[model samples]
Target: MTAAKKIAASESKARAAEFPAKAGEPAVEVEERSTDGADGTRHVKEFVVLKATWPGRDEADSHKANGAAVANEAIQRGLHPRGEPRFDGAEDHPDGLSLTLTYSVDTVPSSVDHTPGDTTTPRDVLRSEG
Candidate 1:
């Protein structure tokens, strides 16, 4: 299979594994559209966003790697992932434009108490007290 195809497949799998099966929630969605330039040439583009609830550290890291791989493949194919813009050398026209992928991992703040003075900062505290 081609590099693009492999990236797509991997991304799909990652999305599937990241989300739990439940009601009122979707794992991934792909949005695509087409537009026309002044010269009557039609330009097609697509963007993808994957959302999951409370993914673990390992899972989030895996998704990040997969997203980067997909973006790299798109760059190689002369296309951008989405929301990315480029400029061309032509005075009236841009040279190249493509989509770029950005991925982020959401996490909740730790509940464990870590306030200062709650725990001994120095190892000698116990020895001094004893």
Candidate 2:
């Protein structure tokens, strides 16, 4: 069976719970940023980006599958998939397709910065920054 069919809901939830928000971890958020234009005008755009390190193989695989599901759902919603598959560095398994999915959230740079003295801090950052 395919990876999607093989993984059950409980198994996925268990895997996800392993990576809970620690006392000090980046908070993932979705927001829009102003894009500067050549003519000096700006436009707001929304994006999804995330940077997380999985602790083990199972967690990594779980994360990858989760990302693929999101992408596939987006495709179903009419968002065109961009670019060719960059599976060159992906691991191969004897079973079905074995791949990892990495996703990024495109937020305003100011939204992610955690440096001291910054005025705008995300809720997660503020909770842990002190």
Which model scores highest in TM-score?
2
Model 2, range 1-130, lDDT digits (tens) per residue?
6777555543444335422122111121111112211111111122222223332456544444444443343233222222211111233333434433333212222323344243222222223312
Looking at model 1, the pairs that clash are: 80-98, 80-99, 81-99, 81-100, 82-99, 82-100, 88-95
Worst 10 residues of 1 by lDDT: 31-40
* Residue-by-residue lDDT tens digits, candidate 1, 1-130: 9999986786566446423112111222111111211111112222332333213356445344444443343333222233212121112122224222233211111122234233221222212322
What is the TM-score (0 to 1) of candidate 1? Answer: 0.22
Stretch of 10 with least lDDT, candidate 2: 36-45
Give model 1 RMSD, 1 decimal.
20.9
Candidate 2's clash total is 5
